[model samples]
Target chain A: DVKVTQSSRYLVKRTGEKVFLECVQDMDHENMFWYRQDPGLGLRLIYFSYDVKMKEKGDIPEGYSVSREKKERFSLILESASTNQTSMYLCASSSTPVTNYGYTFGSGTRLTVV
Target chain B: EDQVTQSPEALRLQEGESSSLNCSYTVSGLRGLFWYRQDPGKGPEFLFTLYSAGEEKEKERLKATLTKKESFLHITAPKPEDSATYLCAVHSFSGGYNKLIFGAGTRLAVHP
Candidate 1:
């Protein structure tokens, strides 16, 4: 079975603090994504990396950045955490576009900014 | 722009009741439509994927069907364990990089 693991399941950070959320997938997938889930807005993509050292901005990428030094690991960085940034973060991985399967998502990390 | 919208923000049903959730979308070219079940505080679990109109896929008591502009997920004789948030997403062929546009999702609650 494919497994996507997040570094932390719950996190609390103070305002103006820098935060890092890590995600690792064991499926050797080529595509990785980061998304934030809010109460009524659902999941909005923050960023995605298709290969090592390659990244693309999604719909809501402000205040967020991502790093992909290896194909199996993706990290989401919050330059300066704020109360408004508190939400559930999810990481996912997929094989490829041509013969794509659904994404395998991590359990998710709930971040609380104070 | 590719967009997806799910209807009936929330639904309440009794055990053994059957109903359908709707997902409407508009995109340049529809590559795929996907359904997922998300439990509270957890990531979504893949349910089914529909590639074209008239295509149907089923697993246990859930059936998903697609049309030219929308998809329907029908739940048959649902049980309490089936309660969860149902999400729909659309992959646009011209969107570049196979990015999926998702809907807000429909929350379903089943009573025993």
Candidate 2:
């Protein structure tokens, strides 16, 4: 089975602190994405990388940034965490073209900004 | 604009009772529609993908059918283990490289 592994399951950070969430996929997928899931709005994309060192801002990328240094690892960074940034962060990777394959998501990281 | 909507924010059923969930979408050019089951505190698990209207797929006790305007996930004789939030998302040719548009999702609870 394909696996997307997230570094942390839960984290608490002080407001304005720098934070990092990591994701690594074992399937050698080419596309990786970062999304934040909230109660009413569902999952909204933050950033995505289609290849190493390549990134695109998703619908909601205001407070987040991403790094794809290697094919297997994608990381999401919060420049300065805020209370509004507290939410469940999800990482996903897809190997096939967007039209043909759905994403394989990690277990998720629940981040709380105080 | 590309958008997706799911009806019945929540549903509760007794064991052996069956029900259906709905997902509605509107996009410029539909590429695919996907169904996923998410357990609490866990990432979503892929269930099925429906590419075109009239397409259907099934697994265990779950069946997903898609139409041009919407899709339905029918749960047959559901069990307690089937309780989870069902999400629907759409991938379309809007910006050419746009990400999938997701709905709010239907939270289903099955009682034994």
Candidate 3:
């Protein structure tokens, strides 16, 4: 079975603090994604990395950045956390387009900014 | 622009009731249509993937069918544990990145 593990399930951070959310997949997938889910808005993509050291901005990428230094690990970074940034963050990974299986998502990290 | 939309923002049903959820979409070229189930406080779980119109897939009581512009997920005789939010997403072939555009989702609650 494929497993996507998140560093934290719940986190609380103060305003202006820098935060890091880590995601690691054991399947060695090539594509990793970060998304923030809000009530009534669905899942909005923040950023995605297709390969090591390669990244792309998604629909809502402001105030967020991502790092992929290894094939199995991806990290989401919040430069300066704010109250408005509080939400559930999800990490997912999938193989390349030709193999095109749906993403396997992490349990999710619920981050609260105060 | 490519877009995805789901209907019935919320649905309430009794155990053993059968129903269907709708997902409508518009994309330049369709790559795949996916259905997922998300329980409260958990990540969405993949259920089925339909590649073309008239394609159908089933898992237990859940059945997913695809059309040219829409997909339907049918639940037959559901149980209380089947309650959750159903999400639909579309992948566009025109877009180089295989990013999935998701819908807001349909929240389904089944009471015993």
Best by DockQ: 2
Over A3-113, each residue of candidate 1 has an lDDT whose tens digit, in order, gives 999999999999999999999999899999999998778789899988999999988999999999999999999999999999999999988853345688899999999
Which segments of model 3 are wrong by more than 4 Å?
A: A98-100, B93-95
Q: Give lDDT tens digits, candidate 2, residues A1-114.
A: 889999999999999999999999998899999989998788998999889999988888998888999999999999999999999999999985463558999999999999
- Give all candidates' CA lDDT scores: 0.91, 0.92, 0.92
* Chain B TM-score for the candidates in order: 0.96, 0.96, 0.96
Model 2 segments beyond 4 Å from truth?
A: none
DockQ winner between 1 and 3, please give it.
3
Estimate TM-scores for all models.
Answer: 0.96, 0.97, 0.96
lDDT of 3 by residue, B11-85 (tens): 999999999999999998888999999999899999999999999999999999999999999999999999999
Please write out the lDDT profile of model 3 over residues A1-114, one tens digit for every residue. Answer: 889999999999999999999999998799899999998889998999989999998889999989999999999999999999999999999887424457889999999999
| Model 1 error, position A109 (Å) | 0.6
lDDT of 2 by residue, B1-112 (tens): 8899998999999999999999999988888899999999999988999989999999999999999999999999999999999999998655447588889899999999
Stretches of candidate 1 off by over 4 Å are: A98-100
lDDT, candidate 1, residue B20? 99
Better of 1 and 2 by TM-score: 2
